[model samples]
Target: MLRLDDLTLFTRTAELGSLSAAARELDISPAVASAGLKRLEQQLQVRLILRSTRSLRLTPEGEQFLAHARSALHSLESGRQALAGGKAAISGVLQIAAPSDFGRNVLLPWLDQFQQAHPQLSLRLLLSDHVADLFRQPVDIALRYGEPEDSSLVALPVAAGNRRVVCAAPAYFAHHGQPRQPEELRGHNCLLYMLGGRVHDRWSFVRGGESQALTVSGDRVSDDADVVRRWAVAGQGVVYKSWLDVAADVEAGRLQVALADYRGEATPLNLICAHRDQLSKPVHLLREFLQQRCAELLARVPWA
Candidate 1:
């Protein structure tokens, strides 16, 4: 009989593109992991992974096998969840990935509260401005500000009313003068943020059913979003940022919204998971908790 654990190890190794990384994630030794893969291949009578010193790649057979492997795992998980009646005790490592500023400032505290509610549940958080791959990484779920790029994943609506605002520090506006229209932003210095290897210099806004993308320039650019927020706070330049990121600064008189009448369309916040059927009990509970607490907060914000 083929062991399900071996098949799972194979899937993780294939997804991560490394045997050692998958072994480390599964808390098994490298040699043991290698042996398990070998055993699985022997039973299946086919080579699964093409391994080299530099990297690991799945064979044609491996690629086809992976789909069935994941589906089988998902079905098993679904059966278990059904048996437990959706009230299973939330235990096991719940891995999550999220952006930096929002993760640290907002979601981090809520995550803490969730953990407190379920003492048995463990957590592993990967906070980065760069978007994390749910399949490639070991994370069970991700919190993204915009729509998911990958169609393979399932995105749960976390916040629908969250919006991006064009803003600048009061000092910056006093010195450079705030722009009244979207086109005027080209004359002012605009702080830029780089995400996924592209600089977000094109600021978009919709007014009276017309949308425009204003290309702006700046002196400072950073890959880390939190640093960009800091630069905006220091009166370095005007910035196009999420309202949740600048709400405190705006309320405290540190920053002021510019061209509020032409604010950009709201982007939804999504809780993304790889396979809905495979979603763990902790992930389901976490999604519900976030929808109740986090989504409500953003929904109530006065965007105008």
Candidate 2:
């Protein structure tokens, strides 16, 4: 059987990327940390890592073993916390990953209140437009928009909202002329989003109970949603985006929603977590808080 101490040491080492770093995190000496890893490798009869003066690299065996070790460590720690009655409280680090736009405009602002409510909890928030691999990364929870393709995760629909109609600034509309039908968008300058250099230029529209999809081409394309919104605001081009993302600009008359009668389907936002038989108190609290907050946000949507 693998020792819990050795597993803990191994996980810390992998996470910190060096014996000295792991030692600092675990409150042990570098020699002790190195010795613990050596003992673990000896017991398993497999070399887990390749060390050099400049860097440490994981062997293929180590990469595979780390997954099992992380899962096991999580289970062991959870079990220990469960057994430690009386003071069985939620007081540990919680890591969350979310999309940049949503995280900035929605979630991050509310974190102050959550932090106040749970002062004992240490929160690590990672914001990126890219999806994070929860199993590979140490993320405890993720807030994702649109439908998730992965069925292995437990997803809770937390918010529902509509996608915005393609819109442009009044100045741009005056210069390019307004598109009366979805097809007319082909003649206009459209701001597009590029995912890894491939244009995500498809615009979905609903009109007279019929849905249509338009493939648009544009001179400017960006991976950043904010950049697309800014281009539309600056009268550079038309942009199809979520209302929640551009509602304030639309309200301020910086941008106008084109093809007004043709709005697409409401996208459901979700909170995802690793599937477990039981959830920890911190996870439970965060889920409830997000659910309530999302409900409140959705209720204020003008198109809802």
Candidate 3:
């Protein structure tokens, strides 16, 4: 008989595309993952993976097994949920991933409140600017900005908000003069976010039923959004950031919105989770909590 634990490991490895990545997600050693897969394949008398030094691929047999394994796992999860009913209690560590600045400013305070409400629950929060692979990381849910490109995972929109106006310190605007059009931004110091190994220095704007893209350059750049916000606040350069991060400064007259006519639309925040039927009670509770908090906050903001 095939072991359920071994089958779970096998399914996770196949979904994640690597034994080491699966091990990381499962909080186990690669050796354990390898042994589990070996045992699983041995019990079935079939080759499952075409292993290589640098890559992993599922064999035909493995592919077939994966479909069945996923379905079975889903069925098992559904049954468990049905047995527990809707009032299942939660008590476990819930791992989460979120952007560094957003997590620090928005979610951290709310998390304190959430913990107070549920003392039995613990949380492990990972803050990063780049998107994390949920199947390769030990995360129960991920808070992502913008829509996810991956079709395999399930994404739920939690917060509706917009990108901030292109803004700078009063000093920087006085030194460089304010830009009237998107094209004029080329003459000013513009900060950019690097995406997908490229410096996204191009700014998009729409006015008078037309759209334009402005190419910009700057002497200072960093991957952290908070660093960019700090530089802009200190009169170092102009930056485009979420209003949530700069709203306080804007209200305090520390920073001013530049080229307000060309501001872009808001990007919605999303809660992402693996597409699985057996979500634990803790995950469900946290997801609902986040959604409720996000909704309440967005209600008070104009851009949201």
Q: Highest TM-score among the candidates is held by which one?
A: 1
lDDT of candidate model 1 versus the reference: 0.83
Q: Which 10 consecutive residues of model 1 have the lowest summed lDDT?
A: 295-304
For 105-201, candidate 2 gives per-residue lDDT tens digits of: 6677678788888888899998877787776566777887777778887787766664656789999999989998999988988898765467877
lDDT of 1 by residue, 1-304 (tens): 8899898899889867899999998999999999999999999999999998998898999988886787687678667767878466767667799889778877888989999999888998999988887655667789999888889888888776788888888999999998989899989888999999999988888888788886899999999888888899999999888877777778788888888788575767789987776566778889889878765566545445
Q: lDDT of each model, Cα atoms only?
A: 0.83, 0.77, 0.76
Q: Following a full C-alpha superposition, what root-mean-square deviation does model 1 have from the true structure?
A: 2.7
TM-score order of candidates, best first? Answer: 1, 2, 3
Spell out the clash pairs found in candidate 2. none
Top candidate on lDDT is: 1
Prediction 2 TM-score vs. true: 0.84
Q: Write the per-residue lDDT of candidate 3 for residues 1-304, one digit (tens) a residue.
A: 8887787888778766788888898888888888998998999999998989998988888877776776576567657756878676555567789987778877898899888988977898999888887754556679888888999888877766646568899999998888777677777777766655677676676666677776789888778777777788899888877666566677778988776666554667878876665356666677788878766655544331
Q: What are the models' TM-scores?
A: 0.86, 0.84, 0.73
Candidate 1 is scored at a TM of 0.86
For candidate 2, what's the RMSD?
3.1
Q: Where does model 3 exceed 4 Å of error?
A: 8-37, 46-82, 86-88, 174-181, 207-210, 248-254, 276-284, 295-304
Q: Identify the superior model by lDDT, candidate 1 or candidate 3.
A: 1
- Clash totals in order: 0, 0, 1
